[model samples]
Target: MSPVIQEPAGIFITLEGGEGSGKTTQARRLCDWLTAQGRHVLHTREPGGTLLAERLRSLLLDRSAETIAPETEAWLILAARRQHVDHVIKPALQQGMIVVCDRFSDSTMAYQGYGRGLDLRTLRTMNKWATGKLAPHLTLLFDVPVRLGLSRRRGQRSSQNRLDREATQFHEKVRAGFQTLAKQEPRRMVVLDASLPLESVQRNVTTVITRWLNARRRQPRQR
Candidate 1:
């Protein structure tokens, strides 16, 4: 797909990890901090953002819903992502808003590609097509052991989803997939030890993001 809009002036940041990796919390914190710095921030999440995309998110996560085929799951997520990018992310970025998304294409690659045995290359192409090649300026991958992450999820009384019910091996594959991806794109991705206390993890995240923003500010602007 062709570019939906010219390169955006704003920064795009995404958080990725297995269940209970504190991505949502960190995303909120980052957005709050960015807003405090007088930046226009748009905090959003994958598989859901716009109305249509949210509906798809429901279908994707509903445990009572019919067993969706693996390919069907991939298409549904891509469809929601297409809507999300077109309706929310792209417009926000064009308006010079820092978009802090909870999960994005990387989740799909980790879940369906690694967890469900899908083709990573094909999924990458589909993700590019869905989002019109809009990639994040920074991605924070919260790394944690599969058992620990799953245990945390089990302890959470609310927000349990179908994905959370997957076998341990599935989550292990997903975790490994994220590790591989972070290694492949070290510049754009920062792996954080998520097993640390909330304050410690947040401190690391804030430090890394603050340094990145400062560095970007020091760079000469393009014509």
Candidate 2:
């Protein structure tokens, strides 16, 4: 079923990237910045954010979990996303709270469709149904080389997960998928160099988001 579009006062922003692209860190930074400005913000992540979704995340990320089929993985992610949207994202936005999400439907497209060789067209349709066609107003894609991003993850003790154990070539495909997506949706997605120093990346993120917010403020409200 298609979702009825509702014009919300709050904005939805999402962060997308391949493994170890610093999405979680950058999302937190963005939330802190927005919170400092006296804005009501909800910082949450995908495959999570709701109680059931978090359990799904554990299953998806657990290295010890049974080997999951590619289609099964895709369906699990979509299920979690549906719950997240219904229980967390939709309500927050309706309440006029800016929602900064760590990952969203794009991750499914990149990871499952691209990395696992699933059909992109089918994935897109499923994602729309899962999310009720609730597209993010802005998506910040943290672009980084596969090797570099993987290396950064390896350096961290807590970063190891099921996805992190995938073949290097799989990650390359996912990275390429993100690039292809960015090219296709240049207006809604902004590519930032995640290889830069943390402070530099955050600076660019702040500047880009600031401009978007300013322009949003200038627009007349829908009656």
Off by over 4 Å in 2: 1-5, 220-223
Candidate 2, 63-172: lDDT as tens digits: 99999999999999999999999999999999999999999988999999999999999999999999999999999999999999999999996859999999999999
**Tens digits of per-residue lDDT for model 1 on 164-219?**
99999999999999999999999889999999998999999999998888888887
The Cα error of candidate 1 at residue 4, in Å, is 14
Per-model C-alpha lDDT, please? 0.92, 0.94
Q: Count the backbone clashes (under 3 Å) in each candidate.
A: 0, 0
Worst 10 residues of 1 by lDDT: 214-223
Among these predictions, the greatest lDDT belongs to: 2
lDDT of 1 at 35: 90
